[model samples]
Target: MSTARILIKHGDVRYRLLKVEAASDGSLICLLDKDPQPLKGGIRVETGKLIAEADLEKPVPYGRFSIHTTGEIHRYSGGQRKDTIHIEPLHQLTKAHAVGYFSIPTPERLDTYDASKHTADVVETLEIPTEVSERLTFLLEIGPKALKVATYGIGLSYELYTLVSRSAAARLPEELAASFVEAAALTVFDSRQIQKDEAELRFYQKIYGQGSFVFRENGGAYVALTSVPMARAPTMRVEFDGSELSIETIPFDAQNKPTHKVRFWIRDKGGRNKQHDLREHIRSVVFDARL
Candidate 1:
């Protein structure tokens, strides 16, 4: 039941796992690791992109870890308290089989609303990643639960983008090239007071779809938009509140090949009174595709 014991089980030979929880808004203030290193800094023992029945036989490196993930979207089994999982060995012990058992408490509440028509809660699930041990305890306070959580939702894509840049590519994996590309495509606006207005969220999402690259409103008081690829460029100038902040982007070509240099720049006045500063923001511009 303790996070430490559960994490050790997370890496068991026959597949260990635990049920971790996350907040709806996605801010994880709880620390999972006693030593608390970023998950991105840890190894990415590539849990294959998708799980197929064929993956069990796949020979992942012995020393390297595999981050196998599984999910369930069930109706809480009509008052069933637990779910059973099976674990089997690979390599020399291919034919041998064993089962590791674990269970999670059903959600305290359940509802039947909207689109899916599935119960709102009461269902729970687990995802297991292979590792030396579950050293990251804080994760339980911040990660997705197995069944109800979705792996492909928009929010997760952004979080993973942060993970890849700050931890995975920049640190252990040294996936510099790929990280650059991801960083270029992923943009995180460091806004102090973000607006949560649905109309505003939809407005910005539309601008992003238009490919205008960058959009700001309310006198730069809000983050209206950013481009997927343009966000990741290496060198660019951002003019905000009469101050210029230079941010770097990863260099990637149209063909996905590495390039010598790439840049993006932003210049928008909050209002007519600030229009005079726009020229100053555009001191110079250069884009060499050949590089």
Candidate 2:
């Protein structure tokens, strides 16, 4: 049986797990280490109602869903609590999971981080410069917090919004909040140390369900890029000089999901580029990508 230890902390925050074990059967358990009982494992910061990411692979008719995680249990759907599109997709990738910010332990990400320090603090202690750290911190923490505030409405989640909002505006920077609302977001997870260019595909999720992408860059944990949604405008907009591409599409299926596609291309003499080169370009821009 294989065993691992996970340390979790954030600037003297409430939780710091000295040992979080991942059992062989995929069931997780808090181990005999660090802090005290009620250490709070499910502290998820849902910025707002989840606009389900479209699972085009298994598109369900509107007003109905069969969630795969829960034994394919079919559940009725309703109109969105917020003014955003409610597409039915599976899973969301937030900094909370990437950095273990009050989330259940997942062995894959934790094993790659510093085994002796909290995931968040290890990110902080990387000495990656204050401005960059602040940007990353906001991306993983306050930025997501702000997104929740922008799309809140009075429904079953009214109390939740009120509770999170009490400290949302006071604690978040106005500019970062505004940026998240007005753009498509990209999160790049670097895995060079593990000897791979693309570690895994993170489901790119955003408020409006605009397309998102993830890949690794050097010298950082991850990077994000956000752009305004233009699902059917037919404009060929490009960012990151030329490594990244996003364009509107005149397409719709049964669920009215935006059929936009993102393409990554790097310039070359043969009008083609290798995947490694593309990874390098994005990594070089991680610390300086437009948010």
Candidate 3:
């Protein structure tokens, strides 16, 4: 018993509805207040493929009948097409729906977008900035395993790299490793926006700069320092020599006075210090200490 307006368009021709009724077979018998004249070639349902065409030689007994869930109706003028009327369920047809349907161009075949081709087009068009492209290319050359270890050091879960890498491999551009690392870092750090602590913010900021990290070779691992200046006592300190990487945490009492301290060390594995192994060692130590 509810009344709704469904506006349908076929090229230059348009249909304004007076009311609609539900048929027994789940089709809609739309009653038109005014029908477009000269709808000669009849009404043909145009989905990805043609469904069926109805003859307009005799006026439709009711108004227009639609059995399709989604598509358009083409009203032809003799041998040539005249209008195209987009059709949707009464429950979905709205002013907004009509606008959105007309705004986007519908493809002839309803298929998934080609992401590889899109990426190739973007690269060929030189859409990415030169500096960003270079950095991403460098990250790609370093590989995903190394990037994952670095992300782990930055307090991301280990599985994050795998998830991002798999998705990027399937749908993203050629800079798969760079994309994975960037996505993982953004996901992890976005949550840190609520952090108000100055020192903690500075720590993450220093480690993540311009979507990349600055690391110096120390002991068996590439090391970075928190190095935030404190008014009373140092909030935290990370020190690395040729032998070990030491992280120290100082806790304060209720009076904001230094009470107790905790510290840990990741020892160098001598000549076995490949970048990945060193990074893994740092991640384990930091993760265990809850730093």
On lDDT, the leading prediction is 3
Across 66-122, the per-residue lDDT of candidate 3 in tens digits comes to 222222333222234434444332222222111010110111111222334222111
Which residue ranges in model 2 land beyond 4 Å of their true spot?
1-228, 231-261, 274-291
Among the numbered candidates, top TM-score falls to 2
TM-scores of the candidates in the order shown: 0.19, 0.20, 0.15
Measured on C-alpha atoms, candidate 3 has an lDDT of 0.26
Q: What would you estimate as the lDDT of candidate 2? A: 0.24
> Whole-model lDDT, candidate 1?
0.23
lDDT, candidate 2, residue 287? 16
List the global CA lDDT of all models: 0.23, 0.24, 0.26
Q: Which candidate do you rate higher for TM-score, 1 or 2?
A: 2
- Candidate ranking (lDDT, best to worst): 3, 2, 1
Q: Cα deviation of 69 in candidate 2 (Å)?
A: 19
Q: Which ten residues in a row have the lowest lDDT in candidate 3?
A: 99-108
Model 2 per-residue lDDT tens digits across residues 1-291: 123332333333223222322221111222212322221111112463323333333322222111121011122222122111111121231222111111122211122333355432111111222232121211111112223433221111110111111111123333233211211122233211221111111123323244344333332122233333333422233344443422222343546432223233444445433334444334232111232
What is model 1's C-alpha RMSD?
20.0
